[model samples]
Target: MQPVVHLAVGYLCYAAYTRLHHGREPADLPALVAVFAAGLADLIDKPLDAAGVVPVGRTIGHSLLFVIPLVLLVWIVASRRDRRLLGVAFAIGYLSHVATDIPWHVFSGDFDELGFLLWPVTEMPAYTGVKPLGTVAGIEITTLWLEAVILVAAVACWWMDGRPGVGLFRPSHRA
Candidate 1:
C-alpha cells in the first residue's frame, strides 16, 4: 500500500475507535502525530528496495530499535492521559508500514550465518516463510500500504482529538 492508502485506512479505523471509546470527539494530538509520522517512515522502503539493500519480502522493516525508543521517549514526556494512546498509536502506525508489504514477496527461512539475512524463503522452514508485505495478519512491509493506512488514521485522530493541533502534517498511519 501507499502512504495515501495507509492514511485513509488509519483515519477510518481510528474514527471507528474514537466513536467507540470517546464518542465522536478526538483522541490525542500527539498520538495522531506519532502515528502519522510512523506512516511516513514507510516511504523509506522504496529506496531500500530499489537499491537492493534487503530482499523485497524479508524482515527488513521488522525492527523494534527505533519504535521502542520512540515510545519510551513519548511516554516519559507526555502526561499520563496522553502517553498510553500516543505511544500505542505511534508503534501501531510504524508497524503498519511493515504490514502493508506482506504479499509482495515470499518469505523464505534461509538466513545468513549470523541469521540477519533471510534471502532464501524456499529453503527455510515452514514458519520461516512469511508474507513480507501486505495487510495479511495485520503486518505491514510496504511503504505504500502503511503510509496509506496511517494517513487516514491521522485524520481520524485529528477529528477525535479536536484540540490544538499536534502539527499540520498528517501523512498516514499503520501497524
Candidate 2:
C-alpha cells in the first residue's frame, strides 16, 4: 500500500479503536504516534534496502518476528510510564501496515508473497518490480482510485472527529 493509504488506514484504525474503547475521538498524541508508526516499517526497511544493507525492501521490519517483539517492548515501556494507550495506538498502526501489505496477495492466493513475515525463517520473494511512486504508468488505475477513496474517507473522518491532532501544532498560549 502507498504511504498515504497506510497512514489513512492507521488513523481510521485508531479512530475506531478510540471510539469503541473510549467513546470519543482519538487523542492527539496517540493519533500522531499511530500515523508515524504506520510508516515506520517502510522507513526502516526501504532505507536499509536502498543502501544495500538489506537484500529486500520488505524483510526485517516487515517481519512479524521483529514487529511483535518491538511492539511488546513498546507496550511494556509505555505501560510502565502510565501511557499504555500510546503502545496500543502504535500496535494498531504498525500491525495495520503489515496487514495491508500482505492482504492483497493473501486474497489472491499468492502465498509466496507472505514469506517475508517470517524473515530469516522464510525468505522474502525477490523484488518483482520497482514500486510506482507518483507515476501513472506503473500503477493500476483501480489502485489509484482505491487510494483516493481511502484518503478521502480518512480526511472526512478526521474532520468529523474534530481534527484531534491539529492542536499539537498550535503555538502554546502560556505566557
Q: What is the C-alpha local distance difference test score of each model?
A: 0.48, 0.86
For the record, the alpha-carbon RMSD of candidate 1 to the native fold, in angstroms, is 10.0
Give the Å error, residue 20, model 2.
Answer: 0.4
Provide the lDDT at 133 for model 2: 30
Candidate 1 Cα errors over 4 Å, as ranges: 34-41, 57-59, 62-82, 100-175
The local lDDT score (0 to 100) that residue 34 gets in candidate 1 is 39
Candidate 2 lDDT score at position 151: 90
RMSD of each: 10.0, 4.0
Instruction: Give Cα distance to truth, residue 163, candidate 2, Å.
Output: 1.8
Q: In candidate 2, where is summed lDDT lowest over 10 consecutive residues?
A: 127-136
Mind sharing the TM-score for model 2? 0.88
TM-scores, all models, native as reference: 0.45, 0.88
Q: Candidate 2: where is the Cα deviation over 4 Å?
A: 129-141
